[model samples]
Target: MYTYVLFVHLVAAVMGLGAAFGFPIVAKSAKTVSQAKFVLNLLHKLEVLPKAGSILLLISGIVMGLLETWLFKEVWFIGSIVIYLAVQFIVAGMLPKNMKKQLAALEGVQGEELPEAYLVLGRQSAKLEGISHLAAFVLILLMVFKPF
Candidate 1:
């Protein structure tokens, strides 16, 4: 059972990272309102897939941690879960909000008019995404090493 779960969790992580890499290209190419909406929808769907994966990973992680006695005094184990949750909210909630607001701002403007607002939001998104990647990597390393 744990083996099956670990497999699923790893697969989910790969899929999630793949989606993250692809998002910026799609987002930048969004020109019209419909395009923006479409991209946003796709982004949400993609984001949800990873989120589901993370949940499975977390549930299985906790179970495995206890059953295997790996969680004892493991800061990385705890930190990974906490950081992943934070990133989940940031990506799914804040990132989407930023995208929508930028798109809305674009609606009334012309000629590649992405406002300074988007720059701020984009920077924040990048930071969050970077942190998520790092957390995921740390989690993987800790899982593999199990060095307590």
Candidate 2:
């Protein structure tokens, strides 16, 4: 049962983080206003996978922690959970707002070139995304090494 839950957790992480890692790549591919709009729409739809994956990750992680109660007391586990929640806030809360602002900025633009506002928002979003990715990397390290 624990192994099965662990398997689900791993799968959720891959499905969620994989989709997330691909987002900037997809967004970067757009060369025109129309393409940018289309890409943003596509990204909005693609968000479902990560959202579902996050829920699964949370559930499976909690179940595993419950099953192995000692994990709840471990510093690495606690840190991982904290980092996960922080990443979730950035991913679920911050990123969407930034994307919406980007969309709004795009709405007023008249050319193939992305507007300065949109570009600024994109850079901000990219920074947030980078931070989330880094946090995820730290979570992986904590999970793998259980240092402390």
Candidate 3:
């Protein structure tokens, strides 16, 4: 049972965190306002991967801790939970708001080049995305190594 839960947790991490890493690249690839809007819309749709994966990973992780009993007391586990919650908070809270602002900034524009406001917001969002990815990597390390 623990093995199965662990497998699910790992798979969820890959599905969610893996998809998240692509967001910055995708956001950067847009050459025009329409293209940017389309790409951002696609990103919004793709968010399901991370959202569902994170939720599942959280549930499965808790189940594993309950089953194993010692995991709850481990530093690695506790640290991973803290980082995971932080990443989720950033992903769920920060990214969407940033994206919405970017979109709103673009809403009135009509051109191939994005407005300065949109570009500035895009850079900020990209930075946050990079930070989120870093947090995900740290969580992965903690999970794999279980280092105290």
Q: Count the backbone clashes (under 3 Å) in each candidate.
A: 0, 0, 0
Mind giving the per-residue lDDT tens digits that candidate 3 earns over 1-148? Answer: 9999999998998898888888888999988999989998999999999999989999999999999999889999999888888787789999999998988988979777888998999989988888988888788789889889
The window of 10 residues in a row where model 2 has the poorest summed lDDT is: 108-117
lDDT of 1: 0.68
lDDT of each: 0.68, 0.92, 0.89
Q: What is the lDDT of residue 32 in candidate 1?
A: 55
lDDT of 2 by residue, 93-136 (tens): 99999999989989878778888888888889899999998988
- Which stretches in model 2 have alpha-carbon errors above 4 Å? none
Per-model root-mean-square deviation over C-alphas = 3.0, 0.9, 0.9
Clashing pairs in 3: none
Q: Which residue pairs overlap in candidate 1's backbone? A: none
**Across residues 1-148, which tens digit of lDDT does each residue of candidate 1 receive?**
7677667767877776677767777776765556665776787667776667666766777776776675646876777677677777876677777767765665665555455665566567667667767766776787678654
In candidate 3, position 38 carries an lDDT of 96
